[model samples]
Target: INEDSYGVDDEEEFHELDMTGRVIANNYRIESKLGAGSFGQVYLCEHVRTHEQWAMKIESHAMNNNPQLSIE
Candidate 1:
């Protein structure tokens, strides 16, 4: 699910890098933030249906925000 949406890697696996409490795919609810970095951050999330917990990694997508890169 966490591939690359709008240059943001919202979800991956065992490393949900989004670092947010926002729900993804209408399933996982981001519980809290574990850590952060230039690439992304890890998040604690819970499954809405089964009441499961997991760590999700999300990419920061800092590359797209570069000052030099721009679309004409």
Candidate 2:
């Protein structure tokens, strides 16, 4: 996908903490980093069954503490 389509300024925004390992949430397994920010990281994931590509944005501790930064 084009970089502009994701609306991310840089790939660095998607860095994940070493302690934060891959997780399966809502039946989706996070594959890799797609993009990120101070609040969270967007992961490139796939459907276990359908094998479809999808993006999953996970909130970080810093973001959860700050109520102002919210995704609409």
Candidate 3:
């Protein structure tokens, strides 16, 4: 897997905060950015307590109108 971690620099930190708002479900913390596209961005996240990791995708609603897909 790509090991290029993020949030260590200013630009990445800004993206991290903007995309994830720090953490989700009060359990996962974003570790790095994986990829991005017109839809939005994907991230590498870790469980705060268990340290387990997973990939997360955050889609920008403003980037798409009358979407064909949704996470739910």
Candidate 4:
């Protein structure tokens, strides 16, 4: 799902605040952003199935080093 689909504003929405506690993809629960660089944002997602969380990173430098930027 697109982040804008949720109607979240950039200024009003802060990654740290949102990452505090929230669920995404109706399955992967957001734990936190492991790190954020020029590439993109990396988040720690928890799999609802096995309750196992993994590091999911998204970048926006398409055609470069990283691609696909994710906002949450």
Candidate 5:
């Protein structure tokens, strides 16, 4: 059976901590969780000024512990 990945790339995966309702870099505010994976998690954030929504990926410490990890 042939499976389609919808152009998804595992090498481009992201990981991050959940920062719900928290502001970062004095620019954007984390809102909610979008998804997660073995490496990290993704969150939904918004711009403080324009209120534009964005998807952010955060790599976890465990992922960084491994030298083979993709995220630096």
Candidate 6:
């Protein structure tokens, strides 16, 4: 599926981090972006060993400076 299928536009100004194809926490491999908003982006990820998929919500650091809103 293309970006249009996910309602994402290439011309939009987004602050979400692009983590697709990257491994997180040394286990979860990021697959694709599911959705994004003013807060952050959600990604479809998979467990490298078990192949279990999960949705991970990651906040955009460029949006705000409040420490409470950060996932890191």
lDDT of 4 by residue, 1-72 (tens): 334323334432333234535666678777887886655467888888899978865433331332333223
Per-residue lDDT for 16 in model 6? 32
Q: After superposition, how far is residue 9 of candidate 1 from its true place, in Å?
A: 14
User: Which is better, 1 or 6, measured by lDDT?
Assistant: 6
lDDT of each: 0.64, 0.56, 0.62, 0.55, 0.64, 0.68
User: Model 6: per-residue lDDT, tens digit, 1-72?
Assistant: 112213333324344347689787788899999998766788999999999999987655444566766454
For each candidate in turn, give its C-alpha RMSD to the true structure in angstroms.
9.9, 9.8, 8.5, 5.6, 12.5, 7.9
Of the two candidates 3 and 4, the one with more favorable lDDT, higher being better, is 3
Clash numbers, per candidate: 9, 2, 0, 0, 4, 0
Q: What's the true lDDT of residue 14 in model 2?
A: 36
Candidate 1, residues 14-37: lDDT per residue as tens digits?
244343657888999989898865
Q: Write model 5 residue lDDT over 1-72, tens digit each, in one string.
A: 011221334534323233588776787788999888776667789999999999876655445567756443
User: With candidate 6 superimposed using the best TM-score fit, by how many Å does residue 70's alpha carbon deviate from the native?
Assistant: 9.7
Report the alpha-carbon TM-score of model 1 versus the true structure: 0.57
Candidate 5 lDDT trough over 10 residues, lowest sum: 1-10
Give the CA lDDT, 0 to 100, for residue 57 in model 4.
53
**Rank by TM-score (best first):** 6, 5, 3, 1, 2, 4
* Regions more than 4 Å wrong, model 6: 1-16, 62-72
User: Candidate 2: what lDDT?
Assistant: 0.56
Looking at model 2, which ten-residue stretch has the lowest summed lDDT? 1-10
Leading candidate by lDDT: 6
Best by TM-score: 6
Q: Which residue segments of model 1 deviate by more than 4 Å? A: 2-20, 63-72
TM-score of each: 0.57, 0.57, 0.59, 0.54, 0.62, 0.63
Alpha-carbon shift of residue 3 in model 5 (angstroms): 38
